[model samples]
Target chain A: MARLTTPLTDFYAVIPAGGIGSRLWPLSRADAPKFLHDLTGSGSSLLKDTWDRLAPLAGEQRVMVVTGRAHRAAVEEQLPELADLNVVLESEPRDSSAAIGLAAAILEKREPGVIIGSFAADHVIKGTRFFNMAVAEAVEAARAGFIATIGIVPTEPAIGFGYIHATEETELEGAPSALKVDSFVEKPNAHTAEEYVESGDYLWNAGMFITKAAVLLEELAKTQPELHAGVVALAEVWDDHAKRGPAVDKIWPTLKKIAIDYAVAEPAAAAGKLVVIPGEFDWDDVGDFASIAKLHSSGYKKDLAILGEGARVLSDASSGILITDTGRTIALVGVKDIVVVDTPDALLVTTTANAQKVKSVVDALRISGRDDVL
Target chain B: MARLTTPLTDFYAVIPAGGIGSRLWPLSRADAPKFLHDLTGSGSSLLKDTWDRLAPLAGEQRVMVVTGRAHRAAVEEQLPELADLNVVLESEPRDSSAAIGLAAAILEKREPGVIIGSFAADHVIKGTRFFNMAVAEAVEAARAGFIATIGIVPTEPAIGFGYIHATEETELEGAPSALKVDSFVEKPNAHTAEEYVESGDYLWNAGMFITKAAVLLEELAKTQPELHAGVVALAEVWDDHAKRGPAVDKIWPTLKKIAIDYAVAEPAAAAGKLVVIPGEFDWDDVGDFASIAKLHSSGYKKDLAILGEGARVLSDASSGILITDTGRTIALVGVKDIVVVDTPDALLVTTTANAQKVKSVVDALRISGRDDVL
Candidate 1:
């Protein structure tokens, strides 16, 4: 993979940052979502990390973020270099279809045929060189008028993510490694995931999509015309601050809530208009403590991984991950694969195997009307 | 079982309050040991509960506490009804032999042939009627010049406690249920403990000893003459406040460090001067979180036992014990048999199977010079 020093021409980056991240409750809350948190233990937050990764490829002036109004201040605070016009705020979440669709419509209105790449703000990526290489190839495939998605090389038979099946028979011009997508599949069960990993043609869909703004809008118009019309109407008035508020207030609520994968990628793949770019970069969504444990396992001491600044922890015959935000000293004894998240106001204890079940705790708290903690 | 309303005549209660209780770390610290904590969630400290239980049997005036100098203020604060003369404090710990012997020597000096029953301050007991019946019968055996011990009926093959072997062939005259002690054994391995439980002749020693103060001192004179002489010397001037400090400071350091089980009980049992009284009351030493879990299992919700006042906890498919002192909300998800102790300065996470290993965490903290948390 070659590292590109110069920014790609006519390329715009759109970050869709919205999710309650209930599985990471107490650490990732409703008001403070996962993207705003420095879950990687890096000095910068996930949002800032995403910005840093994309700024070299898309340039600072061409980067945009679409987030809920509640997180607008946090996004702006985390990325001070972001232009005010590029900060698109939603009154409420309408899911990925509206978020990315509106960004594509706005970018298309700003500059015709602008190649826009949409990436999630909360995902963690390593190997910036490979990431840049894959994005550049995806951009080339996008310039040839095809919706291109970066399919992450399968590292394990992970059932937590959707898969993209691509055939090597048809390769796109200019994009040397691009392959024709056969289909987009939903999250599979353990047996199916194992088969998919063994097949070598399946890749984990990391939700990285690159396409010309016109091409994405065209696909959305074909699959979800009502949502496409709602976004296009809002995009026409988005630059006009005077008309933007009323337009969003009227049109945003009327848009059908759907994910971009379902609204465009699946339909486009079915119609033979989508291509997959193989991405060899290491990626993690940081979806649960198990993902977190895997990310920080390299820094484990006595088989225990501890995350936080100046955290005091003592472990004896213990193998676990401790995420502490408080000044209290945590002691672990004779535990294995445990996850302890200790915050000032709340504490969560579970195991890495049951990391996905933490959402039930949040559900319980919500049902019991503990909105104060939620 | 019968309950006695009136205080027993000529009967005195001695409480030996000591031990760091490292197994309950973060909840029990060196400065504040287990006896000072309200571990049972009964709104009273263990020492206070011991005083309340014994005050009815032995009048408040006849109750005595022997603890380290550091815990004197806490003991006094928890038991305001305790007389100043009865609050005996050792400058440093010298094991139970010295602590209990000094109390016996002092009571003998105040009144010869006075019957004193020594009970630990940290043990939990239920069925007050059965406990009173056992204690009354033990007192009768004590009056017959035999060292009487309340032996708990075996509920399980618990290897954590010592056992007393009692023969059903010989019985005491005054105490109808009293049996002759064959021998007292130290803590055994799992196989031996299982065998002891199956034999039906072995009983768990709850360390409840009832004997005449003069007889205890006489027995101590035979087995441990030096310790007996030292306690007698300290007891001579214990009432004189002006001379007490210098006497304790001089004699305490020279006293032998030995547990009463080794110095008195084992030797007396071998000499056929010990008797065991069956106690059917539910008793727990509260040795670790496992014991704490068993003691409070009846109040468990969803197989989880919680011990704290006004603690906010949410459990989802979790079976464990949570002992929290902080205002933080503790949420347990998909964890089984876990033990979480959350305090202001320190937090502890372990399992009921590994509860005893918590002492190793304290040891590590001490070795690492983290005395502030210890």
Candidate 2:
């Protein structure tokens, strides 16, 4: 916990860490957003989990975090072992594309021919052994001149994620499950998701992408030429240490706001230059309260998913999640499929069926000028 | 606020306050039961409401509250105007029959012809004008050597309360609405409740009984002789302040536990000496969280019934109640008919339909040795 000590690896891991996670409101807020919360009941924040997952592969010095300027202190505090130079700070949000592109550029400039894998700071991935195996395959595929995405084999007919279609096996060495990407589809309806699951060709696009730093820049240059040049310029000044502030303030605001998917993945797939490492590891985005409920209700809780510091008393209650950070005893009676999140300043009650619509409550509160709560 | 100043009526009022209100658990606890809580959100507790309704007719000196010894301080603190000698504190709970009979015997010993009306401490009643009129009629009927019970005209076919079957219209000169009670029936099933509501001869037995102290003692002597004689002997010693404690210590523990309705009302009805004064008034026992929700979902909140302090931001929620004493902001999404009660140490979440089953939760917690929350 005090210092970072691990064997060195060539490839750097980049975490694009920013999002309010408005759908998990009351628990997730602008001041302390999704990445800062321990939504998975794993006793650490999602940002910390991301660090723990990547640190073994890349070492603490090689694992870079790209986050908003407002969250720089929090990121540094959470990842105490993170090297000062490895923390990439943006003046304001420019979306996933610019954030990850900046990290790729910095790593490419510092060490030539370096490979980097971009992961979001607020995702939950289980089975570290399987994840490490998939990442190793992804690294091999990335070095073989392909933009590699770690596509999780779909466990259920989930419509909440984009689907990566793997068409045929590739002849990539050291990566047995590497497949040529057919296309990437947007989140589908239930029927389409069911069809995708049944077809056995579709994997959930977990937004994990491994690529040679120069290759990603090359693809970015072709798809989003201006954004690529801007990140490259910021990366050059970022390495100078003293000039990062002025450089970020000048270029980050002008960078076109877009996600990495629209900026690189879609175009790379269309050009037939994308390969996917099919990963059977259990993964979840922890997208909403419903997902968290699912995580806790798996084994320990057959009926009630209790998280944080509190006791629970259930009477005729079957399925629900109760999260209490305020040390309050929760009693549930005759309710099912419910979610109750209790904090000091705010409390939330909703059913898992309506979890996706929680963002509307945050929006409503914002409209009413209750920014103090939001 | 300080002292009693009203002129006393001939009949004294006895508030038999002892039930823990287990149905309204977490909010109503053994330490602070329903009578001590402001279930109506009207700024005063139910016990205070009962006193407000009765203090006009019987001065504070004449109003006696018979409660368990543990609640003596709470009762005295809430009713500061009440005379200390008028507070009857029992060593332990012995049910309504002993609690009320003791009050009657004490009043009868103070004055041989005294009429005393026993009222429960936790029922909510609206229209003070109607309540005053009913009490006036019942008092007149009580002086006519009949046990007068105020039966509420049923507004709905509720299976939650006992029924009073009145057969013949009585010719009591001052009490025009006095009807000869054929019998007192226990809480019936839905089918019988609906049938009785349509029959136009049955009224809800609200357990408001007015009788000559001697008549109540005489009836208790018939049905529960041992309990009646014990309370009478205790009353005799109670007049002498010094001997009261030893007398209660000796006799209170020997009194048999029973409800006044079973010991007196039912047996007196069989003897053709019970008369019911039918009174129509808005009344609720505040039996559960569902009743409290109905109270608040009256004029403004057509959907969400909110009680106590704090603010709520709701989305797609209807027909639910949220009770929060803490100043936490509550956000509820897409839930209907839900009951959420939040306190400093405990929380309860249930549906209004299942509000009656909250005691099971308390039992569960107690079984788990969580008495601190209960």
Candidate 3:
């Protein structure tokens, strides 16, 4: 993978920022989602980090953001360099298919054959050099008339993420590291995930798709004709400020809620039209406190890690993570693998082994009509 | 033990309110100690509870509190019905010997042969009828010229508290329940405590000392003459407003720092002048979160107990206690036996197993110069 110095010609980056990240409740609320937070100790919000990462590959002017109307102001404020016309604000969420498809349709409407790359705003990626080279190869693969997705090279036999089955024999002409996608697999059981990792033929599907805007819309048209038609109709009047609101209000809600993988990528893979670029860079979804604890492992003292700025923590014989949004002094004593998330209005106490079960807490809160904390 | 109806004549209650309760940190601070908190969900602070428990036995006019000057305002506010002269404010802590001895000396000066019963402000006692009966019998034993102390009947082989050895054959003339004290033992090891509990000759020494003010002073004078003389000097001018401050500033610091058990009870036990009144009422020192959890076991939902007013908590598959002062919505998921104390400035996260180790956290904070939170 060769590192490119300049932005790829006609390559547009589209960031679809949605999902409340319920597992990350108290920190990631309905109003303030995970993308708006700095889960990594990166000093910037995930959305801003995403913009910065893509700005080098697809110049600031060519990058676009597709987010819900509720987060439009926050997204705009976070990325002030973003052009007014580039941000596609959805009236309501119809899942990833509608979000990415609408961005592609609008980009195609603005300029035909423009190569667009869709990246999730909340995913964290390390190794800038490797990331740039992977994106460059992905863009090259996309230029070869195939839908390209960057699949993270598996570091562990993780059952938490979906995997992409790729073949080393079939390769795109221009992109050397690119492998033909055989299929996309859902999150596997412990045994199956071990087998996948051992075979060395599968990669973690990180939802980074790169392809020509026209090709994506064309794929969407073949698979989900109703959703493609609805997005296309909305895109036609999207540039017209007076007509955009009315068009979205009429068509957005009617569109079926589906993921991009189920609607486009999986079908394309079956048709032998999709290619996967194995990204060697470290990546994380920052899904829970356990991931956050791993990301900030460097800050751990005696196996205890403290996240968030101005977190005053005193730990003794404790092994775990303390994520404090409020500047309260948190003291931990003889607790092993514990997670203490201290916020102004809400607090979460659990253990690293039980990080995934935090979703149950949020679900219970919602059931108990405690949506205010959510 | 027979329940007494009226307040006993010539008996005054002196509560020695001290100890920062470092093991209960974030909830118990230096300025706001455990005595000021309602660790048991009794709807009032431990100090106020002590006052209430004693007012029935000694009457409101006969009950007095001896606390540090820093906590004078708070103690006065909590026990507003207390006469201004009865609240003894120590300029600097000289341990239990000085605090209790000073109260006794002052009471002796006011009225000769006055019986003063000393109780800690932070202890929790249940079975008011049994407690009143114990106090009445102890008062009878005190009138018979014995340094009477109420010892709790052993419920378990607890190594956390000191034990009293009493001889049932040698009984007080007036108080039939009172037995002659053979010795006072410090906290024993697991095996020794088990033996003591099985033998049935031991009772938990709850630091409840009842004796004539003159007898307490005379005992203190023999064991710690310098401390006894200093307190007697301070007591002479304690009633004079202008001279009280000067007297305390001059004599309080010179007094020896010693517990009443070391200065009087232990020595008196050896001399066969101490009598143990077996108290059948359940008693607790409220020393740590583990004890608080046990005291509030009724509030446990799926093994999780919450102690505090207006504490909004949501727990799932989690056991242990949450003591909240900040009224935050606390959610615990898949954590067992965890202790979380949420305060305005400081928060503590541990487990019931690690409750005793909380003292180390406070020690670390103090060494790091975080006295503001302490």
Candidate whose TM-score is highest: 3
Collision pairs in model 2 = none
Instruction: Please provide, for model 3 over A126-169, each residue's C-alpha lDDT reduced to its tens digit, 9 standing for 90 to 100.
Output: 89899888888888889988999999999999888999999765
Q: Let me know the TM-score candidate 1 reaches against the reference structure.
A: 0.95
Cand. 2 Cα-lDDT: 0.87
lDDT of 1 by residue, B1-374 (tens): 35688999999999999887988888888899999998788989988989999999999999999998999889899999999989999899999999999999999999998999999999998888889999999999999999999999988999889999997644666588899999988889999999999999999999999999998999999999999999999999999989999999999999999999999999999998999998998888999998898777775634999888889999878887999878788899888999999999999999999988888888888998999987
- The candidate that wins on lDDT is 1
Instruction: Estimate, for each residue in A224-308, the C-alpha lDDT of model 1 and write its tens digit.
Output: 9999999999999999999999999999998899989999999999999899999998998889988888888875634888889
lDDT of 2 by residue, B1-374 (tens): 11223433687999999999988888888788889888888888899999988888787678889888888889888999888878899899899999999999989988899989988999999987777778888888999999999999999898778999997999897889899999988889999999999999999999999999999999999999899899999988987989998998888988898999899999999999999988878888888888888877884445887778544546465567887788778888888888988888888889988988887888887888989877
lDDT of each: 0.91, 0.87, 0.90
* Stronger candidate by TM-score (1 vs 2): 1
The segments of candidate 3 whose C-alpha lies over 4 angstroms from its true place after superposition are A298-302, B298-302
TM-score of chain A of 3: 0.97
Model 2 residue runs over 4 Å out of place are: A1-9, A41-44, A68-81, A166-170, A173-176, A223-226, A299-302, A310-312, B1-8, B59-61, B68-85, B299-302, B313-315
Give per-residue CA lDDT, model 2, range A154-243, as digits (tens).
999998899999879998897788999999999999999999999999999999999999999999999899999999999888877679
Q: What is the CA-based DockQ of model 3?
A: 0.86
lDDT by residue for model 3 (B74-141), tens: 99999998998788888878899999999999999999999999999999999998888888888888
